[model samples]
Target: MRYFSPSKAVILLLLTVCCYCTSFSQTEKKHDVIVKLNGDQLNGDVLEISDSTIRFTYTGEKLIYNIKKSEILKITFASGRVETFNAPPATAQTTPVTATGASTAERRNKVAVLPFTFVKDGQNAAQEVSDEIQNELYALLSKHSGVYTVVSPRATNVLLTKAGITKANMLNYSMAEICQVLGVEFIVDGMVTQNRTTQTSYGNTSYSDKTKKNDNSDDKKSSGSASTSSTSVQNYETTMDMKIYNDKSEIVYNQNRKAFWNTADAYKNTMEYLVKRCPLYKK
Candidate 1:
């Protein structure tokens, strides 16, 4: 081997150091992923993890972010390690109501029907009727197979009640909150209106005065008169307004339809029409 000069030795050392540094840097590179409760994934490095928050930085960014632990579903490390986090309990105060509600991962193809708002004679009807309509709608929806999974009206009502939600105050909360509480991908809200539009009265009168044969004698000559009978019929016009919302709290369907026939229970027909035409209805 030939001996190298001072300058050549210095250059060789520098090259070796540079190659080692590059290899070390390559080996040190790491990527950590954060999965949010809303099913959003973030590719970044977890700088620090605390009891309530996590310090993170984007894949190529230098700035750090503090994310709430409650919002994170899991953290996957580049070393093939996964750490999971529990979702916080849902509560009116603790649970956040965003436009998209909770995680969108498992909510697909599920539906919930809420108690309908019933109006009769231009005034609010009884709650029982509203519940009746809800149950009826639920039954109709349950009949269709391979369309979607429908939550029972009883379960939906119980969840709403446990959350202190009622038709009277349902508007106070956003649709996303209700969707999260119900754990469904879609929500069905509706209103039924019935009004008496007309009344018809009909009557008929008959009289018989005839000379009968010997058997009946002159009894018919006495002239017996038949009483008049009258009947009153009330006609009602029924209309139904239906609205469907997705987990994102966006209104996907809004329609109002009136029944072809004016009857007390015409709302049933209108509701059926709307459901058949709704976007969620597969066939």
Candidate 2:
């Protein structure tokens, strides 16, 4: 048997107690987290955080939510270490959990489509693409059985512009407004870009310092000037990024897709691709 001296035993006992105390203290320290919901921010202690949801206590209520990192306008940690988490899982939904067991069946059905933003950047004529995209979308949902029974472009445009979506969005709009625009159960909005170039020839000229300016101002004309023609085919380009929102104005889907006019069938090809990939297409 191994025996410890009196002093050694006392030291070991103290060390064990110290380690236990440190561990308990760490576990007891409340972990702070800030959550933003429906344009409201709440401060609370985090009881659990997982891939699908967060469990927190705030305002004297235990709340559970399905949220994306992007949905969180801001999150401040007690340790001051800021981190970005993943977006919500595709199947995970945002459902309001009521601690008081109250029913919420009277919410309005809202939706929106951000102005199909024109890809004005680079060499794209965003306005043209915007018009075309709007036309295509109009054509698509017009034929969908019940899709347009809720919202239309005319209505969406009026409502969206009122919500300050006159230009491209950098978080300038809200989900609730978007829901109102679409008129359906949700809303879809996105952006686009396109570019092309042409070849041309211009007369190049040179002049002598003394005689050219004084005598030949009218006589010099364009030395090699001749009637010439330039060719610039109408090339097209388009890119789109989209997001869907629920009545609460919470984001449901976010994705980006692109298209360009390289061949005669470019428009058809691009539209087909977008339709196949768009969530609205399936809806």
Q: Model 2, residue 241: what's the lDDT?
A: 64
RMSD of each: 15.5, 18.3
Against the true structure, candidate 1 reaches a TM-score of 0.59
109-204 per-residue lDDT for model 2 (tens digits): 323344566544364355655656766756664454243343556765665555445554525445553443334466666655544444334554
Error of 2 at 194 (Å): 0.6
Candidate 1 Cα errors over 4 Å, as ranges: 1-103, 204-212, 215-224
Put down candidate 1 lDDT per residue, 145-198, tens digits, no spaces: 356899999988888877778777677788888898888899999898889999
- C-alpha lDDT of all candidate models, in order: 0.86, 0.54
- Candidate 2 residue-wise lDDT at 122: 69
* Model 2 regions more than 4 Å off: 1-111, 120-132, 145-150, 162-165, 168-170, 180-184, 197-237, 248-251, 263-268
Per-model TM values vs. the true structure: 0.59, 0.40
How displaced is residue 279 in candidate 2, in Å?
3.6
lDDT of 2 at 44: 65
